[model samples]
Structure formats: structure tokens, C-alpha cells
Target: MRIYLPATVTELGDPDGLVARVVHAVTPALRAALPDEDEEGLEFAAQLLAADDSLDLLGERPDAPLRRVVVAADVPQEAVAPLADDDAAPSAVRLLTAVPWSDVACAHVDEVAAAEDVTAALAGDEDAADRLADRDLLWFDVGELARLAAGHE
Candidate 1:
């Protein structure tokens, strides 16, 4: 199953340092919620949900740069468990094991220009959050993560 893991750039400084337990994926609940959407659309919805959750992760890591990162990985079917309806968003799932770097396909991240908006959004600025919601995160190949994590993006 392909899962979207909320993350921080600092974590990506080392492939082995990127850690995530709760992830977003195309769950049965998500399918039910967007019955008419295509597979790509469904995956995008899950990725957006993961992006939203990434903001919360940023809140906990003040030392990390102000940015949003979502790692896209292909994990085994047995690795994920969809959360109960009342537990989380429809796309949310719990990972049963750590994902090795080899499983990661790529990442979606906020551009450096989005830092001010990300900072504002983290400070509870609704308009800034709305702007972030409308912004498209830049795609990065797994190989470029080390450079990105080094703040060279």
C-alpha cells in the first residue's frame, strides 16, 4: 500500500532518521467518502490530508525549519491499519513497522518561499493557512532529500 507520511526536513537529513507511525493512504473509508473520484484523485486527497497533518508535526518541532514535508512510500499491505471512523480522517492509518528508506518513492514539500506563510499558519493565522491549502507543494525525488534537508532547496 502507498502511504503518505508527514515529516520534517531535518528528519530527512538522514534517510534513517525519518520516522513516522501515523500515515495517510487510500483506505476503504476514503474510497467510500470519494466514491466518484479516480485513483489519482483519491491519492491526492490522501496526500493533502497528510500535508495538513504535517503542520501539527511542525508545531512540535520548533527547531526544525518552517516547512511542510510529506514522504510518499510504498509499504506492504500488512504494514498499515486504517483507523476507526471516529479516530481520524478517513485516509488516516497506523503503521505497524518502520519504513526503510528503500520503500520511499519521493516527497512533497513546501517551497522555501512558503516559509513566511508556513510560519504565519503555525501561529494560527487562518488566511495564511488558507493560502497554504491553495499552494502546491513541490515534488522532490528521494535522491534530492539530503540536499533539501541541508536547506539548499
Candidate 2:
């Protein structure tokens, strides 16, 4: 159950704090989304910690435009599939699994990207929005995210 936790780092605030907030926001979402699971929370937390370690190892700048935390564990595969389908708002955070894209097969991903682009453009960052539009990047799989998410009590 590899999970891809995509996050954005903006110039408005602290990157590390933002990451922590994202983690806090996501933990409960994951738990609610997978009610049958008991240890998912701990596993996800550990995976996030490992992701932080990897980032430190790579000497990644905290201010990078986009930062992703990969979490792997044995949680339910369905728990993370909806992230690719999120398209409601710019600040909408998503958690997705590494399963094939054909599973959800909706315009969710495109819609989300479009919304983000529009938001960026409206904020006078058309260049950034354009860059986002031109690319077909889909953040997938958090390496061992699923495995890590399922290992906790």
C-alpha cells in the first residue's frame, strides 16, 4: 500500500511547519478513510519520519516548490485512491496509493490540476500555472508508504 503524499511549499510560510501540518491533517483523514484498519496511523507516521530522513539525507532545501513524502505500509489499497480524484480547491490536500490510474478512471486528476492552475493564474503566477499545465507529472507511490502505514497498532 504505497502512498504518495503530495505537498506544496509556498513562500508565505515555514516549509517544515507546513510539512508538519500536512502530516497532521493527513493522519486523521487516512484513519477515517480506512476505519477497519488499526495500525495504519503508526505505520504512516513512521513512514513520514523515514521520508523526512530521506529528505535530510539528500540535503533538500526546505523551500523547494513542491515536496512529497512517500509512505509505505499494508493499509487498504482503497484508502488512497481518491487523492488523484481531488479537484475541489487549491488548498485541497490529497493522499493517493500507487495503484494503477485506471482504477478511478475519472477526470479527477485533470480537474484538480486545472483548478490549481486557475488559482495560480489568478494569483498572478501565470507562468507557474503554465508550467504546471504543460507538464504531465503525476506524483505516484511513496515507495514503502503502504507497508509503513499498516505496521502500527
- Evaluated with TM-score, which candidate comes out highest? 1
Q: Which residue pairs show backbone clashes in model 1?
A: none
Q: Number of the top candidate by lDDT?
A: 1
- Per-residue alpha-carbon lDDT of model 2 for 28-113, expressed as tens digits? 44556556756755444434443333333223443433322332223354443232334322212333323232221111012133
Model 2 C-alpha lDDT versus the unseen true structure: 0.34
- Model 2, position 32, has a per-residue lDDT of 60
- List ranges where model 2 is wrong by over 4 Å: 1-4, 8-62, 65-75, 78-123, 136-153
